[model samples]
Target: MFFTLPLSAATISAIGGSTWSNTPPALGPSWDGNPPGTAVDILSGQVDEYLLSGGVPGMFSFSAGTYNVTLLTEVAGYAGSNQLGWAPLSNLATFNPIFDGPDSPIMKQTIAPLEGWAFVINTGGGDVFSSSSIDRFLAMRSAGSTNGWSVGVEDLRSPTDYDFNDQIISVEAVPEPTTSLLMGTALIGLALLRKRYTKR
Candidate 1:
C-alpha cells in the first residue's frame, strides 16, 4: 500500500523563499506593464526557470487589465509541454481563487486597495489534490495614465502575508523526516499483521 499527504501549511511556509535567490533578471514590463519600474516582471520564462532550478517558490505582483491576467495562463509555453515543470493547469483537480477587491460591475472600482474577495475556482470537481489563490487589484497603466483593470495571479503556495510588489520571498525545501518515519512504521506493522493472518 502507498500513502500520500497534502503538504502541511507549516511545511509549505518552511520552503517558501528559496526561489528568489535563483530568480533570473526581470523578464518584461514592470509591475504596471507600462515601463520598467522597480518591481521585477514575472514572465512565464521566469516561472519556468524557477521550477527548473528545483522546487523553489517565488511571488510576483503586477497590475494590468483584467483580460491580461487570463492571458498569463493562456500563454502557449506557460501551460504547455510541462513548461513550468509543474503539473499542468488541466491536470489541476481543484483551485481556490481568492479575489481581494470591492463588489461592483466596474472592474476598476472593484479592485480598489482596501477591498478584496476569495472564491473557489471549480467547486463541482470535488477533488482535494489541487488549489490556488488569486489576488486582484487596479492601478493606473502608467503613473499618470487613466487606464486600469483587475490584475492578479493564481498563487499555488506561499508564506503568510505574501506580497508581490514589495519584496520577493524564497523558501528552502526541506523533506519531512518525521512524517516519513511514521509512514514507514505504519506500513511495516500492516505487513506484519497481514502475514500473521495468512499463517492462521
Candidate 2:
C-alpha cells in the first residue's frame, strides 16, 4: 500500500487568499460535512473494508507498506510555523512531525498493519487539528480523473472563510516490492502456525 500526494510545491504566505487554486476541482467543495468519502474508500481499496470501519469520518485505513509523502502545498498564514505529522487513530494526541515547514522535501514513511494512523497539523500557537475530524480537515477522491486523493485543511481556530484550503495535498498509490515481500512472509508464518496446530 503506497500513496503519491502531489501538491503545488509552493507556499502561499497570504492569509485568506485564493491559495486553493492548486487544489483539484474534482475534489468538490471544501466543507462537505462528510469526509473521507466514497473516494477515499476507493483509493484505499487495497485494504480490507472491515479495517476502514469505526473511525471518525475523515480517518482512513492503509495496508502495511512504505508511503512516499510529499509536502506539495502549505498555503496558510501559519504555513511557516505549522507542522504536519501522523498519529495513531486510537490516539490523536501522539503526533510525530513529518515536516517542520512547507519547504521541506519529500519524505518516505512506513506504516504498520492495524497501526491505524491519521494526519495532524500542529499550528504555530500549538493548536492541533487532526484529519480524523471534519472541522479541521476535509478529504475527497479526485473523481477518478487523477487516480489520486486530495485533502483540504482549515487551519484557523476561528475560520473566516471556511475554505478548508489552507493546506492541500494529492495522493496516489505506488507499488513497492519490499512491501509485497513483507506481506508474503507474514502469510507464510501464519500458514506454518496453522499447519502445526492442525497436527496436534
Candidate 3:
C-alpha cells in the first residue's frame, strides 16, 4: 500500500477554517490582518522559509506569526471531471477547518517528523470537518510530497462527498539527515577496519 509510519510527538501548527496555497520557503506573504497578524494563504516545504509574524523578507530575520501552511496532494489532478474525490484542483491540499473550538480549533496532534500525514476527507455525521471524520492517517515521508492517503468512510454521515481532500495534512521536519548519514558512514568504516585487522 502507501508508505506510512507510526504516530510521534511531532505536530504542525495549523488553523481551522482557512485556505492555503503552496508557497516557497521565504518571508511569508503580506500580513495586514488584525491582532498580531492576519491569516496567510501560503506556506512552503522549507520550514526555514517561514518567519516571525512581521519579519523582513530577503533578509536573515525570523518572521513570527500564525500563518497558514499549505501542502500539495495527489488528488489535485485526477482523471475524473467531477468535484468528487480524486478530482484535480489547482491547489493540492487545502483544508476548510474540520474542527474548531471556542479557545482554539486548530489541530495539533502527535504527528512525528519524517512520516506521511494523510487526512480522511469525508463529509458526514453532524459536521464534516470534525476531527472525528479523520479516520485514516498515513505515513508520509516528508512535507514536500503530495498529501494524499487513501482510507474508507467507516463511520461517516450521509451524502458522502468523496473529496478525500477533506482530510488535509502535510509532512514537516527539522533538517538533520546529514548528521545521520555521517554517523552511518563512520560505523561502516569502523566495521571494515575491524574485519581487516582480524584477517591479519
Please estimate how well model 2 matches the true structure, expressed as its whole-model Cα lDDT.
Answer: 0.47
**Predicted structure 1, TM vs. truth:** 0.22
Q: Which should have the higher lDDT, number 2 or number 3?
A: 2
Off by over 4 Å in 3: 1-107, 110-118, 125-171, 174-183, 186-200
Give lDDT per model, in order. 0.26, 0.47, 0.27
Q: Per-residue lDDT of 50-164 in model 1, one digit per residue for the tens?
A: 2111321232222211211112222111122111111223434333232222211211111111111121222122321212322211111222212221122222232322222
Residues 1-200, model 2: lDDT tens digits: 23333322211111211122223223323343344323332234432221111222233433333344555455456667777776765777787676676454344443332354566777765545443344455545523322234555566675433555556555444444454566777888899899999999
Distance from true position, residue 166, model 2, in Å? 1.8
Among all windows of 10 consecutive residues in model 3, the one with the lowest summed lDDT is 56-65
Cα deviation of 160, candidate 1, in Å: 28
With candidate 3 superimposed using the best TM-score fit, by how many Å does residue 79's alpha carbon deviate from the native?
Answer: 32
**Order of quality (TM-score):** 2, 1, 3
Give the per-residue lDDT digits (tens) of candidate 3, residues 47-142.
312211222111110111122233332221211211212101222244333222211213333222122222323233232221212312212222
Residue 132, model 1: lDDT of 36
> How close is every model to the real structure, measured as TM-score?
0.22, 0.51, 0.21
